[model samples]
Target chain A: MKPFEDVGARAVMILSPGDNIAVAVRDIAAGEKVELDGRAVVITAPVLTGHKIAARPIASGERVIKYGAPIGKATAAVAPGETVHLHNLTSDYLPTYTLDEGHEFLKEQHQ
Target chain B: MTIQAYLRNDGRKGIRNIVAVTYLVECAHHVAREITYPNRDSGAHLIGFPGCFPNAYSFKMLERLCTHPNVGAVLLVSLGCEGFDKGRLLEAIRASGRPAKLLVIQDAGGTRSSVAEGQAWVSQTLAQLQNTPRVEMAIDELVVGTICGGSDATSGLTANPAMGRAFDFLVERNATCIFEETGELIGMEHWMAERAQNPALGREIVNTVAKAAKYYAIYGHASIGPGNADGGLTTIEEKSLGAYAKSGQSVISGIIKPGDVPVAGGLYLLDVVPDGEARFGFPNISDNAEIAELIACGSHLTLFSTGRGSVVGSALAPVIKVCANPDTYKRMAGDMDVDAGRILEGRATLDDVGREIYDLILRVANGEPTKSEALGHQEFILTYKSFEPLGPACFPSAA
Candidate 1:
């Protein structure tokens, strides 16, 4: 195995070298520094494992792409280094229920 | 090409050598535990049903387990008043030519004397089993089972599909692979039915799930648990989509009940839910019960997938744990076998992890102990449950 120089402790893979964003291998603390391409992108916020990060700036409601496909839409603004999590991102197809608006039981029964 | 195995007198081949100590009811459980705890390394596994009520299902399962290929010997601990048919069970084990003895606590004047007698019996039995001959076995002779518990959405994407690929590999190699839990199959009934080799078998698959859903409804769980919701799965149907992926993509050859081994090599579903009224609340109370059932069906080993990360293995069979969630895997790598979480990170593909699981199974079968087994996690749980004999449609090929 070829050992790469230490850039930071961010998760990445080499599917295509030019692909900008790397999926988080482990949960990234809010202030962690990451190595992307040849540049350093310090994480502005925490990133949950299994969720995606933007290679470039994505507009609000724009698709948050993962696995080279769009998994969900951005609920709020996201920066290159900001943590993309449940707060700022949401699934495009499935409706996630919250405690306040408890219609989930009704939805299941009716379905 | 075949691997070496310990062939039992009952004609079953076991990958691991085990000595089983079973208590007939709760009263003699301590005596049974005392016998097993001190000699744990001798493959003495502690297994028993706690209820005093006589259950045919329990009696059958215990009999099958005592003479299981992995179990070279058995020591039966009886309270002297439980309803379990100890006579029948002893006959079954003795008939198999395995050394088996009974220690009745009530008759022996209770705990200390019973434990002393039980330990002596176990030592004698182990010495006899150590002399049992070994034989070479083929992959075609192997009956393997898989199950996923504490499932989340990521489980379907990574661990379940990875296990599915491994299942497909085993089936192609002429090994019988099984996945179970009809209650969890509710949403994928149609899809699962379509995969059956024949149309009648398809209907049988659907009927099994329908029966399970109805049973759970009456028993009051409604196919939902708080851990599932916390893990981000919304409904039973959604959970089903993830849970059903453990079967992989193979023609559903047959459906069988616990203790019923597959006649030939292919993918089979064990219809764990009972027929008629819901006698047992859930088909499996915990992951250990699921593994126990798998072992009962003659599985030499088990592939256990988990997203929340369960650390459990059967007493008789090695359980290879496949970790699904990256965060969970990071937290519990010591407890896991393969980290399928790498697929989500793009560091590894589904095929990579799938092959990893298959390779792990082969290695474990050839005498590589899994992490759970190495940790002495011989967790065994068997409660009361009833299952009807599978109908003719369940196994079209066999007919």
Candidate 2:
């Protein structure tokens, strides 16, 4: 296996070729421009390291691809460089469990 | 490569000769804990099933654990009135040709006396274990298991895949490698099935993951938790892909449930989810439960990958913690054995960290203490579960 540096020197990584999202290898600040493929994609929001960023615009209800497979569906239209997380992307399987502001168990269901 | 190991009468080898102080029910836990406290640094580990009611799964798990290769001897602590079958468990332990003793807290004059007697037995057993025969144990004689917990996205990108690389190395050497947590592999079934040794085994693999999915669905929760979401894992499918990377690229040789030891050396997938209806609350209550299941299946040691950072180690087996997130690694360096996050930082390649893990496994097998072991993290947990016998396709390669 080649070193990760051989892939690219970008702050974000596209795990697989067909993946429409890139994972932040480092914490990326909002409005920071990072190159994906040959084009520059501006970060719309601050993305933490190990979080996902939209590589390209994704339509609502479209499958969100990662690890070369569909991880879930986009809950709403997503712009390039947007953070793809529980707020915008929902699991196609069971609901993701979370806590409400009051620390009560909240089952976040897919839209 | 070979390391000096304790050879059991059953022909299995062990890296540690641990004297297990086990309680049969929740009532006896305190007495058992007291018995093992003085010998905390001497390999006398406290492990038990807390359920007062009888469960066949817990009984089998305890039996397998008592006779596990790593365990040198066992001391059973029972409350006398509890429903756990202490007699059968003691008999099974003695039948394995290991020193076994039982302390009935009621008949032995309750808590104080039971604790005293149990401690005496533990002290004696630890001494006797020193005489266990040392033999040359090769890599093929090893049974290694992998599980990912407290996972983040870097877990898949770094530690999980690095562990996968290490698993591939061990499998290539003809060692037994087991990766589990079917619930975490919900969406990767088809991808995993394609790597099975046979079409039938492939089908069985698919069905196993389906069972996990159904079980989790019944509880209205995927295995993904708030901690997982906090670490940026959105869906169970996304987490599944990350968790699945720990299996490496080996052709999955078989599927075995808890306490079902693989008959031969190869890569195996441990089916941890219960078989029947979703009577159990969750497949595994926590990561330690899964670690206990792996130990019951005869793993000499376990590879634990984490990005969010977990400090747990097992009673019978040594856990090599691979920190996946670079920031987490920085925060929890003392708790981790391998910093797989170096791959993410471009400081090391996957192969580099993979080799580091593989080398550490050998060193740990040769009697080197892992970070957790040195820190006294012998955490163990077991609970109720039911499983039907494995279908023939589950272990086609096993004799």
Candidate 3:
């Protein structure tokens, strides 16, 4: 059987079918070659571990897919073999509370 | 493996027989802590609510904790004039056929004398607990809860799925498994409901998640922590998909609010975010708060999975820490029990780590110390909140 790492983010992982990105398991320097689906693509930027790599080309405002579902929307045009993160994509859902805000909110309520 | 257990009146079995020192309000906290801290070597731990304001949720959580199967006795400390319901709490503990006592600080001659009196009583109760009868405890009678903390990309990819596989094993053996934090289960509510034994139970799952969403929105926030984004999670939906894997593939039998016990053994979801307004702030201030709720609901032991690393155990129940990231495990090996990160490294498969967790539960119940227990990591917390009792639709299997 193929090792589970090949399917996981050891090098890269596609979480679900028809998804737009794969997670980088290790940091790959630019100009290096990485496998995607069946073919090889040369890295355009230094991709960090745990960051997303574009599975295909997409236009701005397009939904970014991970785990086969929309995690967020692209803020700018993302090309294949590029990294996906806060610098490119943004969260569709806002955070419920921050660490500092929670402290303040708790203080106000109890006081 | 069969475990020699402590039988309870409710037909539940306890793995640890502990004496709990409870402070009814914050004013009595110092004296209560002093009474318990030194004797903690003999199985004492401090747990209580600090709020002087009366809260039905805190009251119920206190009742559940004092009567928990893991707790063999309790010492109640109260500073008079607080809004907490001390008498009702004492009655519940006594009703459970365990030793329980209440000391009002003002009547007991203030903090110094009261500490002396509380110490004597704790000593007496602990001696009595040594006589509690031990019978046979088996896997089928076990109730387990899984929680994810400091989650990161590795959490969903490795540790959570491993936990899910272990959960599947427990459910098959007729054990009750509980997975919670509906706030984190934001995007996959419909998928979760479809796995419920009955259709109405599914709808309850949907409603509870919505309650979490609405509750968080009012507070101008979401459940995903900062560590989550630092580890590459971008949205609540992405974090949720990772969080939901802990339940495995069992058909959910019930949905419960905090402090509500299960009627039968199967998979259950705890609806933690409260009903009504977001006045109490965040539903769970930290991971320990959720762990406390699980102990209050009769969990014999808890499975804690973390990606960024968490070192917390609990006051009444043993907590097993499952580490998700290989790198994190290497850094905090002493604090973790199982390295589920082996799944992603290909050193092990999901089943390998899953079986490892299942084995750890049996060994811990039979008196083997988990990494948390051995390291003396018993942490506890409870806060004020409100809730309406979960409805019949939430527990259709019991009907």
Candidate 4:
């Protein structure tokens, strides 16, 4: 495999043949340079391992694909190598289930 | 496929001949625990719910567990007025052709005598089970379930899919494999439905996930935990994608609610969340609750994949721990059964690890104690929830 074809060269892994994002296999520091699929993309932010990074430039409102399926929608245009998380990506199907934010829904149940 | 088994009258074959001492309510837990304490190493297990209010879901769970292929005899400890339906439980056990004894704490002269009677009954039952006769059981007779606990980034990427591979292998061999937690499968149902055996079953799969989404939306939460984010999952959908990996690539045969046995021997989605409005808070309070439901569906053992490392095993069933993260495995190797984290290092492939897990299942079925089992981790829990009776489609041809 070519250096870029091997995602492990950049410490990332692609799950599916049709995935639009690759998961960081190791923490990639901001501004780090890595070659993905034969193209150079600079890490735009500190991306932690197991988190998604845009495999290509994704437009706002575009669905983020992982494991060859849509995981969520991009809230803002995300450049390749940009970390895709809560800031730029939000769940397309349901609201995020956070502990603090979800307390209100369970207030009466807890009481 | 044939192995030494204890055949129950109901046609269910047990891999272990254990005497289960169960408390009907939380009040009788002390006496019940004391009864099984002295014989902790004798395959005498303590299992019960702590609620006094009668719950149909709990009733069915206990009934199925008492008659689980692993249990040979059952001793029910009742507080007398806890509304746990002791008569129904005893009747279910007797119907299965297993020896059952119910000791009411109120009538058995309270705590001391109840413990004494329960201990005597357990010893007698154990002695009887020693001669209960072992029959030949086949691999197709085993029911297994998969669950993810304390998930991290590596879980979905490594351990879960490996478990999925194992599930696929077991399913092909005609073993029943169940994967649950609809609340966790929130967003993957659309794609997941396509993997079903038929269009109707696919629709049922989607509806179950949708029901979970609706149920959790009422409480504004998903089944994803706090440790999930720390391990790199950003949303429930992302987490579900990982959790879904445990189902493997087999066609989902049907969707069944808690306590509903699989109608066929193929992949079945377990709908853990209840229908209608969420009246009973969150569906599954912890990982053990899901395991209990899996056992209720006739699971002889469970495959538990943990990315963050969970050291729990079930009361009546052995749990094979598959660790997803190499780092966590290094720290908690004693509790894990498979080093699935090796996949992350590129040292092993999915098929290689999957085969390892599949072999472990057969070995454990043949009387090998899992790490959790030998360490004495028999965590059993049941919470109150209401399940609507499933119609014909849910049972398929085999249930």
Binned by DockQ into CAPRI classes (incorrect, acceptable, medium, high), candidate 4 is acceptable
Please estimate how well model 4 matches the true structure, expressed as its whole-model Cα lDDT: 0.84
| TM-score, every prediction | 0.81, 0.97, 0.94, 0.93
Candidate with maximal TM-score: 2
Specify the poorest-scoring 10-residue window by lDDT in model 3 chain B. Answer: B4-13
Error of 4 at B90 (Å): 0.7
| Residue B107's lDDT in candidate 1 | 91
lDDT for B249 in candidate 2 is: 91
lDDT of all the models against the reference?
0.77, 0.89, 0.84, 0.84
Candidate 2 lDDT, B1-399, residue by residue in tens: 579999887777899999999998889999999999999899999899999989999999999999999998898989899999888899888888888998899999988888888888888879888989999998998999999999988888889888999999999999999999999999999999999999999999999999998899888889988888989999999999989889989899999999999878889999999988888699899999999999999999999999999999989899999999999999999999998888877888888889999999999999999999999999999989988888889988763
Would you list the rank order by lDDT, best first? 2, 3, 4, 1
What local lDDT does model 1 show for residue B8? 79
Model 1: per-residue lDDT, tens digit, B225-282?
Answer: 6555556454455566667878988899999888887878999999888788877677
lDDT, candidate 4, B1-399, per-residue tens: 457778777777877778888999999999999999887678899899899999888898999889888999999999999988899899989999999998999999988888888898898889888887778777777899999999987888788989999998989988899999998898888888888777777788888888888887776666766687678777789889889889998888888888877755888888888776678788988999999999888888999999889999989988999998888999999999999878777778888899999988888888889999999988988889988888666655543
By TM-score, how accurate is candidate 1? Answer: 0.81
* Model 1, C-alpha of B62: deviation from truth (Å): 1.2
Q: Name the regions of candidate 4 deviating beyond 4 angstroms.
A: A1-10, A29-32, A42-46, A99-111
Q: How well is candidate 1 docked (DockQ)?
A: 0.07
The deviation in Å at residue B151 for candidate 2 is 0.5
| CA shift of B65, model 3, Å | 0.6
Name the better of 2 and 4 by DockQ.
Answer: 2
